[model samples]
Target: MDTIKKYLESMFEHLPKTLEVMRAKDELYSMMEDKYNELISEGKKENEAIGIVISEFGNLDELAEGLGLSKVLDDLVSSDRRYVSRQEADDYVDAVVSRRFMLSLGILLCILSPAGPILLDSIATATGLNLFTGIGVAFLFLCAAVGVGFIVFSNYITKSWSFLNKQPCYIDDETIDYLKSEKEECQTGNGMLLAVGIMLCIVSVIPVIVLDAALNVPIISDGVGPSMMFTLAAVGVFLIVFSSGRNKAYKKLLSLNKKVFAREILQQFADAPDNGPEKSVKIERVTGEVVESDYKDASYSSYDKPEQSSDSTEKKVKNFIKVMVKDYWKSVLCIYIIWSFFTFSWGSSWVIWPLAAILRKPIEQYFLGGKH
Candidate 1:
């Protein structure tokens, strides 16, 4: 039955994708199916048959040694890496997916929340009455409540993964290798996403601008401009957040190791954009202008020059950025909430996120430059 298949999948989800392990999984499934069929033929109820089948074969720990998984299990248990169970993986992954959507949907809801108010305001402007304006304020509060609910629930659900910050995640080496390939096949390719997402966001305000400015439509300022801006910008944000979340989740899973995770964080500072400045310092010959960079201009001629950073300084910088990145997102959350409530100018307000994302790189580079 489908239930047995799902259970089987979940049970093996954390196991290595070794040929021996995979063969064992298939053989076990076939055996269980046969037993299930026998029970059904003997007038056993469907639930009863499933229960018996699971009870007989579902104890993975008891059967692991016989299935030639003793060595794998022993290695995982003895190593410094944490051995993840099927249930743990499921919970963590669910947390990742749910939390991502929570953020995405929350932003979308907040951006669109003003639409009703704007519409009501437009009606009030047309009718010259205060009734619709009052109703619009109430509607805005309702929408804001729903948006906050989404964000809070997402924050709560993501608690399952919060402990990952304190420790490294470790799974089987064989499983890690398998996951590498799986990730390649399914990765969201953020390069394209970044380009497309940023482009969409940059252009999201065009509708409002075109309507109000180029078209010389006074009605646009009354309400339609902001409503359209929210709808469009929210879609762009939804595309980015909803699309990129899976890739981020997979990366989190892979970087459960501290070294790998640290490298990932540090690399953000190391990598230069194709059109961005070089990593090493360069001097402009004609202008005699000094161009500072992430790394010092090291050469045989500069033997007397002190090195870029001492080990202590480098480690401190690393910790600083790690904390900064974490806090940066929290700051962003606060900015989103506060500015959204005060401005109520959805057209201008929704643009903050797109602009904030653009600012993230420079802020990181600044800290990397020892300006922290």
Candidate 2:
């Protein structure tokens, strides 16, 4: 039944959120539900019934045009099964804005990185001060710190917004199409920006070369090289930051995250529903008292031994370990090797093993929604 709802939601995702569209979706859900119930009554298994219903009623183009949402039919036909809600759209926009601001600040700092060194050199030349003084070294460190800080802070800001990686609660077709279009457009823009940035970086050094050879300006020649290099680095940083932000935004809209919905339909073991009425089971307590408790129908029988439960648990743990290694063994190996190379700290490197244990659930959930 939940599968039916998810399918209907995916079909209607591209449509406008209008009253007419809502009416169409409701009518469609009712129709699918009726078909599902009829199939179930015929003794068909639940999975087979769902498959039949979906195949029969999955086409939605004509329904969309009839509902006056023909404008989105092209997208519906082309889009994969993905959806996003209005709130999610708004949240993505907010995240992009915040990320853009941090990236811009980082780029500005990179651009200014050479200024301190150039200014200090100019002051030394003018005042006849020694260039290798303690003050000069301190100024150099300050400029380097600014550049490093900008890079680190920008990365931190971007990582802080990683919560957006979670699957959205609701999604629709229109949202999916919009994101696809935006991703395409952003990719094109990034390419253009990269070309322009490369051209500017190449041209930046021309001024210094021309000043030294064609005009013989020693002061300007000395300062321009550092300035040009800083400018080039800034351009590279900007391109990286801007392109990454766009990619993240598009990924969110695409719902690349795995999502799972599980529904348990309890079937009565008795031949007649009335004979079972409200099902209950009897359990003998350690105190030797027999108690009756409601028991939902499940595949496992009440007569199963306790060892069966233990075996199931053991199998799940083995599966979890297998998946963890399959997904992250390379990363774990790299971390260990890098730590060992720099600090020769094999003992501390072992900490990553425990860290992997802590992260196991999240990594599994990311790829499999925590299902084995």
Candidate 3:
């Protein structure tokens, strides 16, 4: 009886016309009840009447057919599942904006910082400003132009690039749905990861520019702050390289992160109907085919462990966060390394460089050996 109940439940789960099948079953039960009462009134034994009614209920095929299992099964096998989300799309856009902004900022700052000295020198030479006051005015004007120009130019370029690329783009619901239907085996993907990575590279260049501006101070009075700017640029280059590498790696992982719609397929089964022969035959056939000897040995369990939660709306959000972190780890790591280098050059070098060099033996054994 328990086995029978389990089988019935399993069959019920697979029906597509579940509501109609259940309604028909309920009607059949009602008919049985009425017939049983009349038999009792006609002097048949109660248990005998019950036995006849149970027998008359017949096989499971009638119920299966009533539910429409065939079409649902077909859809499940042919469906392509998608693992992308809006969060990934948005994150990618942010990354692009950040990286592009950073790169442009660095370039502009490097130009502007040195421009101050050249403009001052030109004025000094042209006006014969041997006076301290004349030199100071020329320098001030150059600095002002560089600073203002940097702010405006960087902003303009960032906006223009964004527009040109048609980025800050979003994944439409239709596209997501299509992916879901086309890639039936996997849910996660690399498209959004790539997008975010590109964005990050674009935005990470800004801080380098800001730092370069600060470094452009006339440290030696001659027009030779190029060395400092060069070093800063090198740091910027390394950061960009590391970030780009990480983004590429993450994009690959994201692309590889595929998902099978186990829940959706299972739900299709649960939605099967319980009345009629056509649906019953389809259900039985599909289930047999899905669990057949050869097919069972394959990797179809990729979509296993389907969730039964009613909060699937929330599941999308959680899935997005997971995918985002997984896809952006490289970017994050690059950012950290670059940040460390940046801070060391300007901020922590005073304390860190001497300390690290003094402890070089251990530092080399750890970081150099890749043991850290």
What lDDT does candidate 2 reach at residue 153? 56
Which residue ranges in model 1 land beyond 4 Å of their true spot?
1-80, 85-91, 188-196, 213-217, 257-327, 340-346, 358-372
Ranking by lDDT: 1, 2, 3
What lDDT is obtained when candidate 3 is compared to the true structure?
A: 0.41
Tens digit of per-residue lDDT, candidate 1, span 1-372: 888887887677655555877988898899889999999999999999999999998988888877777776675466454555445655666677778788778767766777778878887888899898999888877877787678767767776566665544555444456557756865646556666777778776677777777665445665787677777777677667666566666666665543332332333434534222332222222112222221234222354556665558878878866776655545665677788768754557777766666676577556544222
Candidate 3 lDDT over 155-210, as tens digits, reads 34334324222212223334344444533422233344334434433444444455
What is candidate 2's lDDT per residue for 18-113, written digit by digit as tens? 576788789888988999999999999999999999998888865666655565566445534345466667566566756655644544453444
Better of 1 and 3 by TM-score: 1
Q: List per-prediction Cα lDDT, in the order shown.
A: 0.66, 0.54, 0.41
Q: Report the Cα lDDT for residue 94, model 3.
A: 52
Deviation in Å, model 3, residue 8 alpha carbon: 36
Q: lDDT of candidate 1?
A: 0.66
